[model samples]
Target: MTASPAFERLAIVGIGLIGSSLARAVRAEGLARTIVCADANADHAARAKAIGIVDEATTDPAEAAAGADLVMLCVPIGAYADVARTIGPALKPGAIVTDVGSVKQAVIDAVAPHLPEGVHLVPGHPVAGTEKSGPDAGFAALFPGRWCILTPVPGADEGATRKVADLWRACGMTVERMDPGHHDRVLAITSHLPHLIAYTIVGTATDLEEHLRQEVIKYSASGFRDFTRIAGSDPTMWRDVFLNNREAVLDCLQRFTEDLTALQRSIRRGEGDALFDLFTRTREIRKGVLDARQA
Candidate 1:
């Protein structure tokens, strides 16, 4: 006998890279009996349908969410509150609401109150993405071997949480539960800060003399080219990410600034030993990440 689908109906509220990738993944895995998506961009909604991954597509989040067993807000963090409010009324009893945003604490703050009673919010971050956007950028292979973190609020329904976790597992993700605040703090350092630095470095290059800028691009090394790719991510989404997670990001930025100042002092004072020790420690951290990926 065929096993039951994880969800009777799954509604995704944004059809960009992550949303469309999820639709493809769910369909490929038979995780949902029906899949629907909404995008503020009408063309994106139409593209999602034309691609044949979703059963329905609409510009109205509420209409797509109506009767859905699982509603995933795949929009930027800045739009979370409005989308939650729009879909809250249409959510059926016991529906599970989740998200793929990077920031967790603010997502909970924005989405929790708007959900109807009996609806559970299990905020999640898929910790995987590319510097691409729009429906055409989606692929089913994005989730495999990636970490998906869930941050269920206090007193959240265990069943709903498990259902969502199972769906991610079926997509080939490793699941871990975390406190929302801690999730934000950790991401601020590992993800947010790196993106910020990339943007800054690329932006600085852009501000250089026209000749120097041309040379930089012409002779770009792998390091600078990688920074450009990170900096090329959707500007609207990154703006919202930095705004919505300002407190945590700012805290991390402050610590980073202090460390940077110390490094500058070490260089200015000709303290080669200090620089060597710092480089050695950071090299170990990079090795750890590589080892984990290999394992």
Candidate 2:
């Protein structure tokens, strides 16, 4: 495989799972001559450096971004604006500013105003992740076979967007261009709603009678275990995602709740046919997910 042009330095703000993973991938593929990371949590920055994930690690975002060819924001959506403000003055002219934030429009709105005229803003989301957080949770293989969506604002440089896309492709992702609003709507169903449900069920289980709670944990198998895994994701990141995508998530939630009520009514009325029909339809949905390679 041919190697892409190496960035002089790739700065990653927020040395968490995604950030550290990007660091590893960049180093492993020789995509950058240097990888620098910054984290609000000083210990995380120190840890990333100690583990050799980044050539330089700092607690200040400006220090990390200064002189870098590309800078990727990997923090929670809520922190994007603050990070952008901190790094704006430090970014080099023509530097590409991108992000791996799950919610695209909010991030774009938050970061765009702070960027200098010559700096490029290419908002992106790697439609891939796990319930884990922190630098240690990252691995180079995390991005392989996943989709990376870039939502470039009007008048943004095409060359910058292509460079970011090329970086993700080098890390083993399939790159796609998408509208921010459309991306938000799609993720509301595919990602957000599922996380909300997982959190809800896990929270409900915790409120059960003490003995029942213990039993639930002891007996949790396939489905419940899966929910638990999702519930374990970084609270800060997931919370920001929900708040940033509130409208889309709430719209999806309204439909989901009505469908759930119907299922509840079917079970209460002992309507086997109604229950079976719903179950059959849901099974078909599951099959579609499997066919799409997303299940």
Lowest lDDT block of 10, candidate 2:
1-10
**Count of steric clashes across candidates, in order:** 0, 0
* Off by more than 4 A, model 1: none
> Each prediction's Cα lDDT score?
0.94, 0.93
Over 1-295, each residue of candidate 1 has an lDDT whose tens digit, in order, gives 1888878999999999999999999998899999999999999999899989899999999999999999999999999999999999999999999999999999999999899899999999998999999999999899999999999999999999999999899888999999999999999998899999999999999999999999999888856999999999988889989998899999999999999999999999999999999999998888998989933
Clashing pairs in 2: none
Candidate 1 global TM-score? 0.97
lDDT of 2 by residue, 1-295 (tens): 2655469889999988899898999888989988999999999999999999899999999999999999999999999999999999999999999999989999999999999989999999998888889999999999998899999999889999999999999999999999999999999999999999999999999999999999999989957989999999999999999999999999999999999999899899999999888778889888998998865
Residue 144 miss distance in model 1 (angstroms): 1.0
Question: What is the C-alpha local distance difference test score of candidate 1?
Answer: 0.94
